[model samples]
Target chain A: MLPLRVKSMPADRKGIRVDLQLVADMIEPGTRVLDVGCGDGTLLDYLVHFRQVDGRGLELSPDGVHACISAGLPVIQGDADTDLKDYPDDAYDYVVLSQTLQAMYAPKAVLTHLLRIGRRAIISFPNFAYWRVRLYLFLWGRMPRNETLPYTWYETPNIHFCSILDFLELCREMGIVIERSHVLDSWGVPRMMGRSRFLANLFGVQAVFLLRKSG
Target chain B: MGVTERKSTGQAPTSLDGTGPIPGYHVRLGCDSPLRLDCGVELFDFPTAYQTYGRLNADKSNAVLVCHALTGDQFVADAHPVTGKPGWWEMMVGAGKVLDTDRFYVICANILGGCMGTIGPREVNPATGKAWGLSFPVITIADMVRAQAMLIDHLGIDRLFAVVGGSLGGMQVLEWAASYPQRLYTAIPIATALLHTAQNIAFHEVGRQAIMADPDWCGGDYLDQGKRPLRGLAVARMAAHITYLSESALHQKFGRKLQDRKAFTYGFDADFQVESYLRYQGSIFVDRFDANSYLYITRAMDYFDLVESHGGPTKLFRNTPVRFCIVSFTGDWLYPTPENQKIVHALNAVAANVSFAEVVSDKGHDAFLLDEPDFHRVLTGFISGAWERRQGHAAAQG
Candidate 1:
């Protein structure tokens, strides 16, 4: 019998982005996970190998889906906006949506679906009210273009960009409970904000929140 | 493990033409037992031609059946005995290709109602010892799958590792998952739909009409009359061939360039290279294919409606243990991405383990058979993953 190539975990944990590492920390080991917008499956791969989660992915780009599948990851080419409703209720223990909520056509509907399909949902997104973005827009009176939000106004895919406070307000409106949250600074380092929404919304470049639907 | 005694060693009776013995493993099934088909007909003692690559492992768990498309035979990884050309899927089924014959056992069979050394319209009816021709019972996709199941049972394989194919072959893969879910570990259906669309049936109708309209057809009994309807079969092939390719692929390959001359001859003398290419494709197809078999196979495809026979996607695949991987090509208008996504959505509804990839390619529906790197990578990944998972299960059980 030929020796099959078995994939091993990367030796360096720091190789993953800080926000994704925080998101991974929120998931329980051996849980069923579905990662929407799983580009190249880096986080999902880590979850599967390190956390032993039964992970699947839904990616929009053909290249991302191809890369994931070629690496022996289960992934499908599908849009989160339309394909999420097909999944049955509570089909997975954790459904992770990272850095893609702002680009969605309907973030509220998608959040509703995420909660409906999974027992818990871990979501991350670039904060639109970060200090640098506010400063750039206030200083130039133009749309901000930075490392996180790189695209210009005419070509940006992030149409529904929101701040940390905006996401918390939406979660409150949807009757979703934020079990845990983390705010990240511009260097992809986590900040030690303890439930300070104003400070997090004003200074945090990105945010990760673990959420569940309230009864 | 001792069930290896049933292996056939690729030997069987001569073909219909008696040109020479069929060049692969042949088995005469239903000698004492008859296969009752969906069309209310019993076929007995029929010959099934197939080819196998690699050795079935000791536990008989490494077999991956490769279902062939329309006009494709069991010659999967080797040279075709008739065409003397490379196998249709030579790009994917070789020693180290995507299918990886080195690590997996691959089997491909000429489908029932096919002309490639299989029991079809071209074969003789035992009762009258005459060419069955149009009298052969109309077989459906389920019937084809049933025949394949019998073949698997004959080989003594309790379950296959996977069953994979594209287009018509993909239809067979789906039927396998639906009809005999427990017999295969995983199923990969590429560039296919749950049912034949109305437009699909219309295109098939055109091909069938073209063949029947040929003066030499002689009511499909041309074989018995020692006459071959070459022109009609060629025309049918020409028309059907166009549906397998996209307009952009046609434009890129041939466009409006003159065949050999610098300019048009002011007459219908194969002016455009596309026309000449289609003519050549038509001419070559008739040499190796049987026209009556074409009609029977197309009818089988037209009658294929899994939802009608089984139920809705959820109902059809409810609680199925078979892992599914559905693939589609961007340029495949015949079985577009939406049609393929219907399978994924259906699987998702049941929360069944399924993966899907719409490979970015301009190769059209035939992309599955072409050398598309992304498609190959996807297949390689899915198959290896399925194998690893299966091994993991076996280890846990042991």
Candidate 2:
């Protein structure tokens, strides 16, 4: 497994309209998508309905599969860390791993799998090193208890946590080009998505990276 | 007990020392009731069962109830009792998956008129100590929905995150929205329609008639005689199963091809592979499902006309607030895309935030349950997006 290209979502931001807007722009009519770790197939369903994007997903849950199936969607019972290797090279236009990277045992391997199977990959994850999380750890010594990461340490599923700078550096080292990016706060507000990268790294916690596979 | 008598009791599952293998609630019912048929007859008791998964969150905001289709049980995410198979929707609902057991508290109950664990013709009538076969009130799909509502109420879930299902499950999801809109955050109905068309009813009628025609059906009284209408039920399953698939899928899977042979035998026996396959499907179905229960359940499906029941198509979504995701498959003729489109159109007219997708697949209505990649893409995106929206709102609040 390679080092993960991971970034944390920002803190103290609000507004869901930004994410929807980004999703609307990222996909076009008739584009094919593969959403890895899709929670319940909502975005995939929405994109397909509104943008006419043909989409598929890989989720490890039967409830999600049932929801997907009930929506007449398709999915495979595979994990991002191990199962993604089976997909043929460049089989999809976009392989998306949204809010699922943190749960993986090998985030880099998963990202590489996404890159190998699709032309471009969209990766989204909640930032664990945001200002609020940092404050909690610095002051309380207890694991962060923000709304984004709500579970206790014993039950929490987020394993691989990274900062914005760390993710950008990994992408650069891997020679992967960032085609588009969405830097959102914990509240989902886009503070510096389509603008300056330096400001995004300093303030933006939640980050969405759209990268093209270099290798 | 005699070996024959013990066989009839539906001994406990050997997997978990009678506790059963499951992630949550699991229930099993013996074939105790003599089931009654809508065609004025009866059959001995058949195994009807169900189970529940996930914990009901304290706030109950996480409770989502899943309704199964005809011949489906409450075991949506577990193993089936009689068939010894995994739950029908195990692909979508599980820990760490879309319907994350960690997030939402889920409940799945047997439908009211089902032979499953819920009260139905399969349950023994206390007064007569016999299956209520044929003598049971002819049930409608709405009745099934009503029963599900009762189960939800019993479970203390006031509002459901969503009522989601495909095929017959889809039908119930629609009914839940129309009947109890305020209690739902979302409604996901797949591979179903707003109303059962004349053609759909006619097809169900044909299947019911075929089951009733079986001599062993004994006017729905085969239970007392310890016999089953195996031939009739198998034929019924055969006919109904055909409707579940598209011509293209049939052609791709099993054309006018021969079965395990170089040439046709030219005998009355099954020479074509399709014939043999259908026969096997029919025969295996009889071992698990009861003939009379099939007739009753089909009758219930035929009576599912939400538009007609709601008084008119326009009035149905007049006050609907539940977000909807109605999906249809290109090749599903039984519950065609047009049917789902009608649902989408109605929801749109009512000013609902409804999303719909019609995926192209040759698997027909059953495609909703298969390994279709496009299907998962839309679903995974929808559910997680919903969660993200919720999380986003929380983040903005404080």
Interface DockQ of candidate 2: 0.02
**For model 2, what share of native contacts is present?**
0.02
> Which ranges in model 1 have alpha carbons more than 4 Å from their true place?
A1-14, A186-193, B1-18
The i-RMS of candidate 1 is: 0.9
Clashes of 2: 60
Give the per-residue lDDT of model 1 (tens digit) for B1-398.
21122223444435445566677777778776788999799988788888999888999999999999989989988887766889999899878888888888899999999887779998778888998988999899899999898889888899999999999999999999999999999999999998999999999999999999998899999988988888989999998899999999999998888898998899988999999999999988987888998999999899988877887655888889998899999999999999999889888888888889988889788888898888888888888888898999999998
Per-residue CA lDDT of candidate 2, range B1-398, in tens? 10111222334212211333323332322234333333444434332234556777666667777888887767787766667788888887888766778787767776766655456665567679987788877877776676566446545678888788998899999988998888887888989988788988888888788878988888898876777888888888888899999999999988889988888777788888899989999988876676777877788787778888897866887767676776678899999977787776566444445566677789988998888777766766666666565455447785
Best candidate according to DockQ: 1
Each prediction's DockQ? 0.67, 0.02
- Model 1 C-alpha lDDT per residue in residues A1-215, reported as the tens digit of each score: 00101112222355776777888989999999999899889898899989999899998888888888877788888999999999999999999998889878999999999999999999988888999999999999999887777677787777898888888889888899988888887665686568678999988888889999997
Listed for every candidate in order, the interface RMSD values in angstroms are 0.9, 12.7
